[model samples]
Each structure stands twice: as C-alpha cells, then as structure tokens.
Target: MAVPVESEAPGGRDVVGAVLKACMLLGQFSADRPVWTLNDLTTASGMNKTTVFRLMATLVQAGWVNRTDEGAYRVAMPVFEIGSAALAKLDIRSAAKPFMSDLATTFGNTAYLMVPAEQGAVCIDLLEGRNSLVVAGINVGSVMPYHAAAGPIVMLAHSKELRDRWIKPGLPAITEQTITDVNLLVEHLDEIEDAGYSLSVSDYLPGVAAVAAPILGSDGAVLASISVGGRAEEFEGAALAAKIEKVCAAGARITRIVRAMPRA
Candidate 1:
C-alpha cells in the first residue's frame, strides 16, 4: 500500500492554498461593491478562473457566499449575522447600556454609544427618550462621517492620526453647518479636546443638535463616545449646558466600568 502525502510549496510548507484563495475571494466584497462575478474574483485575486470557481463553489456550499441567478456572487446573510452577533457580545455595549438609558430618560433626548471604525464611527447602541418628538435618524450599526457628527468629531479630536486622515482637503458637507475648511476644523478639534466634549447644532442634520463626550480606557486611550442629541430648540442655554455635563459624567462612569472588567 502507498501512503498519501499533502502537497508542499517551495518553502516545504503544507499548502492550504484553497483556504487562502477562498478568503481572498471573499475579501473582494465591500460596501461600495458588494456583488461580484467569476471574472471579477479571478481578476482581483490573480487566481485562474478554474481555482476561483472551485473556491467560490465551496464558499457557496458553506453558506458564506450566495450565487445569484445572473451568475453574480454576494456575501450571504450568515456573514452579517455573525458580525452582528460579535458586536452584541462586546463588553463595552453591556457596560454603557444602563448609563445611556439613564441619560436619554433624564434629558428626553436620544443617547448613543459609538466606537471608532476604519472610515468613521459605528454606533453600537442607542436609547430613545420617552418624549422625543423625532428620534435621531441614526441607529445601532450606523456609520457616521467623522466631520459631520458630534460623536465622531469627539473621537477624532483624541487622535492625531485620525484627524490627519479624515480632515483632508475638500471635506464633504453633510449640512450647511458642517465644517469644510481643514484649518478651521483642526482649530475646532483642538477646542473640543480642551473642552472634553464636542457640541454640534445642525451640523449633520438640519433640525438636530448633539453634545458628545469621549470614554477613555485604562490606558487613557479613547474607547468610545457617549452622545445626547435632540431637537435644536431643546439644546439651548442652561439646558444644553446641563446635558453636556451629564453626558460627560456618563462617559466617565462607563469608562470606569469598562476598565474594571477582567481581560480575556
């Protein structure tokens, strides 16, 4: 009887080339181009059509990709469901939920917890005020532009790298109030860091206003932000100042709670 052996590459390492090719195929999908065809994957991955087709077939069998009747492919529901489940399991969301609910109820404004993402900030959790006439359009999993919203701006103020990358020339205007000048935005970011919060009135939306504070981790790095937003009229004068104070305090408390959790 002859023994079977796994194939080896030039470096004498067992080749799991199929698995690697499958991952490369899946990585081609993105927010901008979520659907792809066999030719696209073959071109993007630099793999031959036969290899791409075989890997994609396996991925579709495993429910990782869905093949359309038109012969195109897209990431299947399982991928998104798994990603959502992972976000739901994060300790920060659990730590911030109570504080967010309290802040929303106390101010009658929507409260949000957002974490930094590759492009902007991702809202992980939110609580709507009982009397809120109109809730902030953002919900959990919303990705906000770094320059257009108070929550993301506060997160950007803490990091020199993020600010440099995000505040490039010709920033997009989300609304009439959005800061478009790079120099002025940098000055405002410095002010936000000094004030320990960012305040925005109709910066992202016409009738909405928000005040946001950053949550720091044990290493003194910003972990996330807590924001309270509502109608522009409600966030005025003494009441607005009070909401800012409360939001800052809640951020501090959530930070402490996050720091106390045992590391994995």
Candidate 2:
C-alpha cells in the first residue's frame, strides 16, 4: 500500500517549489473531507496561512477551485470537466467503453472505474445504468471500504501477497453489514481469488449488490477494476455470474490494451 502522491518538486536545475507546494495542497483534499478553509489548508499543507490563501486564490482564478462565502474551499466544476474530458480520451477507457456500455445495458447495472488507493480502492468515474432499479447512489470519488465492495476485492485479487499483506490488518466496519473480522474477510477473498471476481449482496449498504473484476497492468499486476452495482435481487445465480464474467473479461481486455501501449 504505497500512497502515490504526484510531483514533489524535482531536485534539478531550478525547481519550482511554490508550484509544487500548491499541487500538494490541492492533493491533500480527500474524499472524506473535501471542503477546507485557509487555516485547514495551511495546517494540512504546512504552509503559512497567507501562502495557502494566495495559492487558493490562484486556483480559484484558474477555475480549479472555489471559495464559499463561509471561506471553505472546494474543487471547482471546470477542473472536473477538464479531468473528465481527459479520461474520456484515455485509450483503455476508450476501448472498453463500448464493451462495458453494452454489458451495462444488458444487465441494466451501474458501472464504475476504480483504482487502488492506500490499502483500498477509490471509484474515479461512473455511469448510471439505464434503469432506475440500478443503484447510482454512490458517486465518483467515493472511497470503497475494503470489506464490502467487489471493486476492492477484484483489484486486490491480483496478488496473493498483496491481498494477504493488505487483509492482515483488522478491517473496519462501515455498517452492520460490513465484515470486520480478519478470518471472515479472508474466506470471502478466497472465493474472489478462485472466481476472478467478487460478488456480494447487501455487504456494504443495505440492499446494494455489486460485482467487480480487476484491471491488470502491463506488469501483470492489478492496476484498477471495473464494477457494476445494483439491488441484491438483480445479482443472483446466473444473472450475477453473467455480469461478473462480462465485467471481468472487459477488465482483462482493458489491461491488455494498457499493457500494449507505451508509457509516457
């Protein structure tokens, strides 16, 4: 579980520390806590309050962030729009969208893009299913508690070592439905490992069902996962199996496409 935060001002000829610090400041905002005031940013970022304010002002001017009348900061819409457009052009997503879309349409299930976070998985983007019956309550950027969702397990199943390493620590209970005990979670992971996907009913939120498969990287390691979620009843027996198989196949396809492409 390495935390991959980007760009800490390279130690080369003439580094831009101020710019890098600002980037770090922006990155510090997490899913659990999105809104922050100048004081909060200054404390989290370890920069002076004046510097934090100035940086936030610059971000606001650039439409990357906004300040509420109450003086808390939030990510601005333009920044999200730019990021979404960029992801729309990512080759892996580009190639898999049609396939995933067809699968979602077939199952009428909500679909998501997930990547590994520090010992967890974070949903980055999502598409609501055509049917209202499919659960679309969780938004993009929601952090999936490792115990409940298919996406986390799918991404984790890539390495027994990685999974074993991550799962060893005590699991947290988000709801009464969450599996907090280590041995119980291991049993669930065993099935996930065997099946190449994870499926669960009402494991996180009551009445929410999900299936997820890992997206492997060029190194044959898990890079991300794609998942479909809905009501428990929708994912049972053959229906659940079909959804898992399609999503897992799509994940593998996306992985291969990513592996074939050269890194920037």
Candidate 3:
C-alpha cells in the first residue's frame, strides 16, 4: 500500500510530501509537451514507477489528469475549469469592457486588451467597431509578436527584462514596414516610453494602423496595454490625434481601476 510521506510541524500538523510530489508531476506538462507516458513522467519526476502510478491514479480519480487509451496522461478539463474560474475573478476585464466598447464605438475601430505572455502579448479581449473594412483578423487569444504591433511594442517598451530577452541579434521582418533595425526599434521604444503610448502604421501588417497606451499597476508597473487599430487612412493627421487622445484617456481610466483593486 502507498502512504503519503509526512513530517510533523511545530504544532504536530502533518506536512505531506506526496502532495508536493504530485504537483511536481503536473508541473512537468507544458505547451511543448502536453502529454506524457508513465515511464516519461517517472523519469522526468525522478520518482519510482510505483509512486508515480499511485499519484497518477489519485489525480485521475480527482479529475485533474486523464489517462488516455494509449496509457498516456494529460491535463484534464478540471485544470482548465480552475484556470477559467480564476480569470473570471479578475476585475480588470470586467472593469475595462465598458470603456473598450465605448472607445470602439466612438472611434469606429477595433479596441484590444493585450497582456504580456512568453516574450509576446496575448489579446485577452477585443471589441470590434462598425467599420466594414477589417485591417487585421485578430481576436481574443491571438498571440501578437513582441517586436511588432502597437500593443505588444508598448508592453515591450515598459517591460525592460522582456524587451532585452526577446529582442535578439536579428529582428525578423513580418512585413516590409516592420522595423528590422534593432537600433531603430530601440529608438522607437524610447519614444514610446517618453510619450506614454505608441502609434504605428503598417508595423505588424500591411494597411493597418494602431495607437496603444500602457495600463499601469498600483506600483506604476505596466500591467497590460489598450490599443485601437484601423485602416491607414483613418490614422493620419487630425484623425490620428483624436484617436490618440481617446485611447490614452481610456487607458488611464483602466489603469486607475486596476490600481484601486486589491492584488490577488
């Protein structure tokens, strides 16, 4: 019979190593390797086959892991459910939705809420305006390149560590308008940080123009970015200035809400 490895606390409360071992097993799964065989997990976890099997069985019973027909293990729906529940608890999205909708409607352009992820930015939410011509086909869950697009660039400009890590020796060009020169890109990032927002034309894709501003946390760190994107013609001259003003105002409102909320 398998037993949880336990240690006594100061008050004699038990600390179970088996639960931590099970968490370690789950932590092995990632975007690169989402599934694992019994032997694979056993080797990666450095736990014996019997212990791994017992832990896997317990996890399967709890609906945290699913055993495939091929005898492999993968994260189950319970994990996604837990993640979704946590996301639902975040007030930023809820607080920003009204302003995003109003901004999109007022400007007749797409408004996006982008958050940093793995050297890139992911669109967490979006509201499409009444414009018939779509500049980009991006939606929620779309990953934007860190080196391109207004939202991602603004995020990178604020996050020094992520910028240094992601910006390498050679910058890849997605479009002809994309900034391939590292020095030029660095200069642009500096301008963005000073101006408190980013405005770009055809930087990520042809015929697209965008303006973005950072949403700051209570500690004045970049929490995320809000961007408005549309056709190139709509982003020129006085129209561009109007868009910048509205986008910055919306960003400021969202930042204030984020700062007021208690950290989770």
Give the per-residue lDDT digits (tens) of candidate 2, residues 76-131.
88766765566555775565677667666888778878877774678777776687
Model 1 scores worst on lDDT over the 10 consecutive residues at 1-10
lDDT of 2: 0.74
Q: Give the TM-score of candidate 1.
A: 0.64
In terms of TM-score, how similar is model 2 to the real structure?
0.60
Provide TM-scores for the models: 0.64, 0.60, 0.64
Report backbone clashes per prediction: 0, 0, 0
Model 1 per-residue lDDT at 52:
79
> Considering lDDT, which of the candidate structures 2 and 3 is the better prediction for this target?
3
**Weakest 10 consecutive residues, lDDT, candidate 3?**
1-10
Q: Pick by lDDT: which candidate is best?
A: 1
How would you encode candidate 1's per-residue C-alpha lDDT over 199-261 as one tens digit per residue?
999999998989999988888777899999889999999999899889988887777667656
Q: Write the per-residue lDDT of candidate 3 for residues 1-264, one digit (tens) a residue.
A: 122323332323474677777887887886568899999888787777898999999999999999899999999998877756655566878878988898789988998999988847999998889982465557789897888899999998888877778877688898888887888888888889999899888888888989999998877777899999988899998999998998898898788667656566
- Residue 185 in model 2: shift from native, Å? 1.5
